[model samples]
Target: MNKKYNIMLLLLLIIISPISYTYNNDFIIRTSVDMKYAFCDVKTNGVSGANNRSSVSRGGIGFGSTSTNSMILMENGENTITIELASLNWFSQDDIPQKERNIFHPNARCEIVVNKMDDQGNIIPLTQLMVKINEDGQPEAYENNKIDSSIEKKIILASNTEKIESDKILERVNAKEYPKDMTVFQFNKKINISDLPKWPWVEADKYEDTPKQRELLQAAYLELWTAFEQQDDSKIKQLLTPSLEVWAASTGGNVEEQFASREIGESFSKQNFQMIPINWNNFQPLIMNNGKMVKLVYKEDFDFSPVSYRFTTEKGTSRVAYHSPIFSFVNGKFIPVI
Candidate 1:
């Protein structure tokens, strides 16, 4: 009897199997305002010779998003990443210039050092990694390289104030993903200040310039800080959102000043607030938990702008912002809601 020798191939496992990485939020946004609505004043240098390109895209951070002062990822396995949001940087394509030709591309590149931890909380080796989530409910790191990451690995939303420098992967996104006409989350429609509507909190009230209000506050805040170093009442009032009347009345806004002494009146005098109109867009009257009539929606940012207010005395110049803070309007006043 002749028996044939059986040959078998054994596969070896390397690195680790089923590597899981989680994020803190749906998508990572850099805004100059608060946390929840990190949709404005984004830092995007990644756009290819286009002002309309966004900084954050499908695979990674956009061109303008990267910078020397960007955040770094230092992990030891199962760690949480904190990414700050900038001002009203995020907007529909129409708001940005040359958007028709420029596409959305997040030049994603970063190195995540996941340190494994022991039961005692000591740093160990690779156990798992993760990225944060975003407002869109979409997670980073595509499956099957569909979105095209240079490296095929578990991806997640990663946020930081510093630029994430990585050679692990590269990703790309085109105009198809971001439709030009998509309505911005909280910003007013594309229109000049001349077309601004009057303040309208309720449906039957009156339409207003939503973007203008935000811009006015930003500019007025700068003027108040610049003129008196914190004592400019007119600017304080002009910058105050109609809905924020309560907060302004209660805390006496402009008492503390913008961030610190560096943010002063000289920083805002040339802004020409005369042309700025009140921003009144999406905000509407809604009942609060206590049945109190209040506008529940106000959009804020989560990151700082790479390039902020230039403090120019020139007319018809771009207005710089401090941060985006989603506010809740109640009784014709603005109440900042994180």
Candidate 2:
């Protein structure tokens, strides 16, 4: 019995010792990305129209996130390395600083990101994606609602970290940006605003016109400027379709209802509040014999200019379209409401 016991003890030691050494003295490791990503949609129930239609999410990355169970094992020769990450702590935009959150800016994301620490403590990256999300109760599923646009999730594979052409990995993922340290974690580039023109709605072309009609187009355009500038809903009303009026009413669509609440301004305070001629396009006639149906677009300056051009000379190049049907031709004017 004593002999058997000795043999069994020796066998156990041989088996357990390897594991102990492997975990304690194997290749060293470190994590570079903020490895937490999980989400939930938030909703509100107080609005009636557009206001009633928005939702702000809360507690996105709830509690009880973990990295221990998810850690991957890396085995190379006699060295055994362990890669681990921490759980995510989530909060609304109001909870964290935007600049800090966007530190890497759009390049850095909430997605999975992987980093590898070499045997010499040198860092390298393997994978990364920002955490993407969906907004709950959004009227438009694919629209750019604050709660809908996902920031994209990032994930990095520490065990996969290699020093070879790091650019290869970036190329494969079409990464937005590359990591500073091949051994450390890296970020992808941020999405370009110009690539997606819907937000500012700036790049679409339409219309051409005869020089004679240019003055008429300009005249009508000036009138439009005055109407909107003076917060004259009636003048604005003359410009809209019957159906549009109903839609506007549904949203309380009067100039006062829209701009007055913001206390934007009452009158022209300057001579050059804005330069709008840049916005008019598709200047041909919308319904005329000489290409008469043209469109005259009237909206706020999306080029990041002030709202009131009321005081400006209102000269230069206006977006007057000759013979445009984009707007109805009321008394030789190119109005877009019809």
Candidate 3:
């Protein structure tokens, strides 16, 4: 009787063991990209919007946001299971200094990491997307806002950092001689008046430049001049916007190639002499029909030091001041349109 009972118990154990094992193995989990890429639709100010909406140009990830996780219900050939995956952190413009922000600022690569559980609390990566993101402008998800118009009203510099109307500032710039001894940043901070072009809903209201716009311009000015002084073609190109045509009328030549040539030429020339930026004194803002659209004029004087002048060596001397290129402010960036 005891042997018979033991045999029956052993049979029951074998049957239950197989059933449990098959239940656990019925479904498998793996990570993959949601070809639909659905999470990129959240829109906020500070990125992209041509139609009067401002977007912060978040490459793809949220600016200053961290990697995140989510779960998706997936179906395999014969089973369905919930899979956990992570959104890996990508690059963001916020990583760079504010003054150095560019269109390709910060973005994360598109990837999905499938996580599997080993121990109750231990998770391991099992699968992931192998594709890399091509960094460029903001992703298409957030590019919906249409900028109402690109036509900006004329910008006029005020004699002082005082609150003044646009017309008053224009009159001031016309009436007074150029201010001296001001740096580019200082020049940008000075009072300026700007107006919106004639809109149907309202007559253009004249107002002092917004604090944010001033700050943006100052940062752009510093970055641009620094890039020029250092003759960094990559940095300069990153900071400026590309023109619509090979020959941009605003810049008077092929924009990218022109800048590249100038920077490269300076590099070769720098072997013999060093050009130092003294100050960016004069500031004039204009609206143009050419690609530059928005324009600012400033005078820059350089100190020329002879590393190996053709003649006898002499102390560094100040080069005559010249007006800078007509820089355009587009999509919150500064580029030499002229």
Candidate 4:
């Protein structure tokens, strides 16, 4: 009789206790592109995340120009990853010698590997996709390349972080920026008023030319720059999407902790620096996810935007640091998506 009662209690415990699920909150995208005279960009789940443009222009081998970046898996179901490569018009702005231009036709070889983190923190590759650009600068499948706009996959999350609600997300994304009266300085230089264009100055994928939308986008970028200059991780996190927050938490502690760990701002504060405003001249709108999201791309590189800082070392050498603060338009307001 005692044994029977104990078994019943065990069954009751099993039934009454909540079932725990590991939801994958983050994944890593490894991108490699070899281009003779072209550039490539990688977009996962409609968000442009990584690219190979920076390496290509620096006169590197341009082979094995790779980047590994962590991205948030927003949900536990199907997610789409799309990568596109385009040829560059190297001599579009300037007249070049025919021999220089004839040396290499615009072509690139690109590969992308998507991997998910298991509960044990091991990287398990989900899929591998590759593409090659022909001499004519058109994308062609390479080695089982079934590149499609709807390349979907089901992902199982391994993290227990609770997803924030959409309303709360909207609140965070729409948080007010620091007032103009606030003194924001970078490298001991006060940031002057932003000169970002309010209208579509260059041709792009799409444009929503509305007074309200433009104002919100401008404000979003200003807030982003302000947060970076102040090194306010909490404020910066407030500007990012909840998915990005989850990605930060999954990798380390939280967004603030992750930013603190990098110490990028602290290092910059120690040096003399010059601020490079957003490349307004190259700003172009990229509509993604069937118009559900939008990204302001610069020179076709989605990861190179918003603003940059040029830090000078004691030896008079300098390196420019680019910040990728992505945003999406939701409910008629702009919010940072990454």
How do these models rank on TM-score, best leading?
4, 3, 1, 2
Which pairs clash inside model 4?
Answer: 22-157, 23-157, 23-158, 24-157, 24-158
Model 1, residue 228: displacement in angstroms?
A: 12
lDDT of each: 0.26, 0.26, 0.26, 0.41
Instruction: Quote the RMSD, in angstroms, for model 3.
Output: 29.8
Candidate 4 clashes: the total is 5
Best by TM-score: 4
What TM-score does prediction 2 earn?
0.23
Cα misplacement distance, residue 26 of candidate 3 (Å): 64
lDDT of 2 by residue, 177-216 (tens): 1211112122222211111111000111222555645665
Query: Against the hidden reference, what TM-scores do the models get?
Result: 0.27, 0.23, 0.27, 0.55
| lDDT per residue as tens, model 3, 119-203 | 2446666433222223443322211233213211122321222223322212222111222211110000011111211111011
Model 3 segments more than 4 A misplaced: 1-208, 244-264, 271-323
Candidate 3, number of clashes: 21
Model 4, span 1-338: residue lDDT tens:
00000111000000001212233334333333333444445665455455544444343324554544423312233445555443333322344443343233444556676555545668766566666654554555444544444333221221111223321111121011111111111010011111111111111223364666656676766666666677655554444435334344445465455444544445347467555565444555556544545555444333334555556556665544555544556434465444
Of the candidates shown, which would achieve the greatest lDDT relative to the real structure? 4
Candidate 4: TM-score? Answer: 0.55
Comparing 1 and 4 on lDDT, the stronger one = 4
